[model samples]
Target: MNTLTINQKNKKNAARIAAFALLIMTIFAGLAFGMIHSNLIVMSDPALTLENLMSQSSKFTIEILAWIVIALMDFVVAVAFFYFFKTTNPQLAKLSAALRILYTLFLSVGIYHLIQIAINLDHTVLSTDIMIHLRSFDVLWSRGLIIFGLHLIVTSLLMFQTYKIPKILSALMLIAGLCYFTVHALYWIAPSIETTTQSIENLLALPMTIGELSFGIWLLVRGSRKPFLNATERFGFNA
Candidate 1:
């Protein structure tokens, strides 16, 4: 094949890879955040939380595994996004990927705490200590989300610049990123206003959830529908 044809083929393959990565990330993220984390972890009552964890040990294990899977998927999604968008702006794409990696690293630390808690389940650790560990996990995860929000913001900008994705999806992503950042920032900066902050965060969850799910579905379904040449031709490339 000629050089142009070869490059076109490679672009198509990369788009498919990006799409598949989005789908995988979405599945694992849903399990981690919606199903396992929400159902398993009780943030309100520590005693009930401990009881639930012990009683549902199998489910708890699955929850931890889901978190690990999400973290791994985060890395894959980051790389895929970088590859998909680097043609538009290499530096911004790289920065977004770095932010995503940092988010994954932070989440891994929280998961480590969960692992420690699981180990201590069989031990004689104090209930208060267990509560502390659980709380730490929550805090770390929230902090990680803030970084992930930044990643999303940069990704959204890249999406807006790209013709392959819809502009509406880019707008949704921008809203989601802002909500994530604002809500988490409130949680950290003003703990005294948690009741109000939490309510707002819950409300903002709508946009965040919808935006992410839509973005994933769009990538999986329509990511490769258009050729990348149109975009590349409009935006000059190093090559």
Candidate 2:
């Protein structure tokens, strides 16, 4: 029993270090994004001139690519977390690993789209004629949100197994999930609801970002714990 506990402790410690590293990377990426592309403007202008449209589109595409990097970092943190818990809770590990794989792939897809957009942005300006019949921004944003919603749902499910967060936290995550889906639905069902969709979707950024940072900090600085050791036992190293 002592050997097993010590092994688990070692694993937890490794995990905590990894989680901290990922969190640091995530924060740095976010800061870089803010600095590099802070002035990116997304506008649906009345004239929709070719220059105006192409410039706006390019900025939007690049900003999204930056956002994808952030999401990928978050996915990495979650993945490291699963590895941390694998020995003690195989079931939760499996769930978290599954989510990590799915979202990593999904984030890759977003990066691909962002690349395609960036490539075309210079050559394909939104002509008034094109705008009259169709718009691609809505499609791109909606699709990205749907994928993100799915990722959130998966992560929340995996989190449930660990029971580390308050039940309300999970519920809030689910609510964020619903908001994601609802925004997409609105985009599809009533095109005019684009503003509403954008508003609600953007509203979630603050809360979700806070939750991820908080979780990362807790997992890193505190690590694991034992019932008998009291709060200090939180330092019990985990993989």
> Each prediction's TM-score against the native?
0.90, 0.59
Candidate lDDT (C-alpha), each: 0.79, 0.55
Error of 2 at 170 (Å): 5.2
Candidate 1's residue-wise lDDT over 33-150, tens digit each? Answer: 7886687667777777777777887777887898888788788878877777766678998999999999999899999998888888853666677778878888998999899899
For 1-239, candidate 2 gives per-residue lDDT tens digits of 67446655655765576567567656655653464333442236434444553657655554666667666665666566665555545675666566556655655554555555455555544445434322444355455566556555654664454434455555565666566756776777787877876787688666645544555565566544422121223455442
- The regions of model 1 sitting more than 4 angstroms off are 1-11, 229-232, 235-239
Model 1 worst lDDT run, 10 consecutive residues: 230-239
Q: Which stretches of candidate 2 lie over 4 Å from their true place?
A: 1-3, 10-14, 21-38, 46-75, 87-92, 117-147, 150-154, 157-192, 224-239
The per-residue C-alpha lDDT of model 2 at residue 127 equals: 46
